[model samples]
Target: MAKGAHGSRQAAWEFFGAELKRRREEAAFTQVELGARVFVSGGYIGQFEQAIRKPQLDVAQRIDETLRTDGFFERMWRKLIKDLPFEAYFAHVAELERLATKICQFEPMLVPGLLQTPEYTRALYEVSHPFATPEYVEEQIQARMDRARILKDATRPEYWVILHEAALRVPVGDPITMAAQLDRLREMVGEHKVLIQVIPFVAGAHTRMGKMMKLMEFEDAPPAVYTEGVHWGNLLDEPGVVKQVQGSYDLLRAAALPPEASLILIKTAAEDHRRCAKST
Candidate 1:
């Protein structure tokens, strides 16, 4: 049997569980009754309602059907697990990315997650999770690829990125992979999907020079800033802090190369990587 949960910081799964419990009660059905309708054991249903276990998609759909909630539980399940591979604290940030009206990012070391290619992403996970199973790594890679679909939507958010020159030059996976990633960046620019600028080494130290920052503005919610360390991330929605971070991001953007020049620089770096790959 799974342990029940009641806590201060309720995760999305917990919220979904609470909602499920409420609906089940309102329908006057016992856990055993609901479990039978969903083809699961009563104990399992109890665990799910308590958020001790996350329901699988099919199970969640069945529960929704049983409760006649018209897919509410199913949709919540999908949103709750959209980025299962990310850290727990970063879940809200992932959700914000999908719904934000505008996204501005400063990447100091590697390609932004939204822009990284599968090959590059795989390489990163492999390095960071040296002991992870190959199957697990592949699952994470697929999740990241799925996240990229947000960029393809016609109603996608406006994206602006400022990448440090080092991110373009660093060899991830191999030179060929790096070149492909750079080419992808160039293609996104050409398609007008995103505007990118490069902060060259010559710019010296500036605001947010050592850390990565993402500022998101939403249509309905207040703006937020997300900053991450090696293993943890913080999402700040306080207006004063968000304003200060936004101001710093603006300064960094001003110091970086303009879009046209940045494109040239990116292409040149891509060519250099291509040559290196050929030589290797």
Candidate 2:
């Protein structure tokens, strides 16, 4: 079985590659010895590190049990299966989310994609995308909803969002639907599990409004950043690029309302909407 067989094209071979290298080190085996144990060529191991390909399940299981990694590879395999239909662009983002220890998201426009309520998400999508007809809308909804599971996974990672004020004020769909959406945001904030900060309209002349981004950190690799525009997305791996994005986000965080303050703002907005709904 080829490395791609395990993941096919779920988008983060580099992560799988890093995991393989880390396990090999923990097992105290050279690539040649580890490869021999798994019946893979030593060069195959090299390629896995290069992320040119990944190892198959049979090989993955052998290494996992031998190194006592305790189902890391097995669980990874399962997650990859669920994300099989991920688009190439989405696949890359999904992979980062999978391996991330912590994720910091900045939605200079709408709510961060991962934390969006279904109705709000659909509203945003419908406005931006002309291609999502009724049939496609449902498909897109399922795909978007699927991402919410990551927040509840056993390996649940920390989530932090910096939502721009415009994202909250602009009523998507309608006032009623937008009210429900704000209420959903309030509920999530109440859990105390996710932290949210609002970048007010007052904080003018900011950086990167046209592009939204997520900063992902993994156990093995250095942290990396991803930014997306209206159509295409770009991943930044270089240390300099990572630093720039991280710094910009840090500045954004400083300029925005603190988490606790943001929660109050969100809750107040929700209540105001509910009251208006009753009066109508």
Candidate 3:
């Protein structure tokens, strides 16, 4: 069965866990015994059963083989993940965004996802998936817009974003789209909805110039750092690594233009886009 929507991801996971436990017991295998077959630790098996962690696809397949469920676990894994709006690797990050009390992000060459306009998102998707059907592209665009709604919630996280000047100057969609997107950023800053800073081109050779990172803090759990590369993402929670990432973010923040100045830059960028649009 397919999960319904955003809130249903947890329910789907719980179902996955319950089914795993039932099948494991039916096979008369202890968690340790099952772990041996799946090449994971007994504690890891327990974590899966408790839904404390999600297993990789290969592990799910191994579990299916070990329990002789005829690919039941693998199918369930696909159902749970495939229905998500985000990419498989980014699904967990979307979940974390809802739980975070504060979020700090640095983008080197693009506007952060939460601030992207539909036209801008469409242009990006079209370029990335040249052969994708219009329906599929629209679906992805809607998903991105839905994700942006986190900022609208009354208990929204404290959002802080640092963008390199390249993000502002690069034309995403046409001049019209760029103008609209920058105007959106200007509105967010003007309303005090978010804290934004820009690292101008004048500030060269800075830390995190080629990396995009997000730091999220939760009310009860330890903070985490997320970094993404082409087609992959890594979520880091080790205390040492988190501390180091936090230090790097601090340095980047120090190198940025303040909120007031950044807002001005954003407005200027919007005007430039407007002029370009009029010319073309």
Best lDDT goes to which candidate? Answer: 3
lDDT tens digits by residue: candidate 2, 1-280: 1236435553565677788788788778888888888786676688667775445556678878877889887677556645554554456566567678899888866777677777887887788777778877767777777767677677877888888888777667766777788777777777654788998778886877656889988765567688876566776656789989999889888888987788777777677766777887
| Candidate 2, poorest ten consecutive residues by summed lDDT | 1-10
Instruction: Record all residue pairs in model 2 with backbone atoms less than 3 Å apart, i.e. clashing.
Output: 3-54, 3-55
- What is the C-alpha lDDT profile of model 3 across 173-217, one tens digit per residue? 898898899998988877766899999999998997999999999
Cα lDDT of candidate 3 equals 0.88
lDDT scores of the candidates, listed in order: 0.84, 0.74, 0.88
Model 1 RMSD vs true structure: 11.3
* Steric collisions counted per model: 0, 2, 0
lDDT (10s digit) by residue, model 1, range 1-280: 0012112223666788899899999999999999999987776678677765556668899998889999999888776655355666665576568778899999998999889899999999998999999998998887678677789888799999999999999888889999999999999999988999999989999987898999998765567788999888877766799999999999999999999999999999999999998998
TM-score ranking, best first: 3, 1, 2
lDDT ranking of the models: 3, 1, 2
Which lDDT value does model 1 have at 141? 87
RMSD (CA, angstroms), candidate 2 = 9.1
Q: Comparing 1 and 2 by lDDT, which wins?
A: 1
Q: Highest TM-score, which number?
A: 3
- Name model 3 segments beyond 4 Å from true: 1-4, 17-75
- Backbone clash pairs for candidate 1 read none
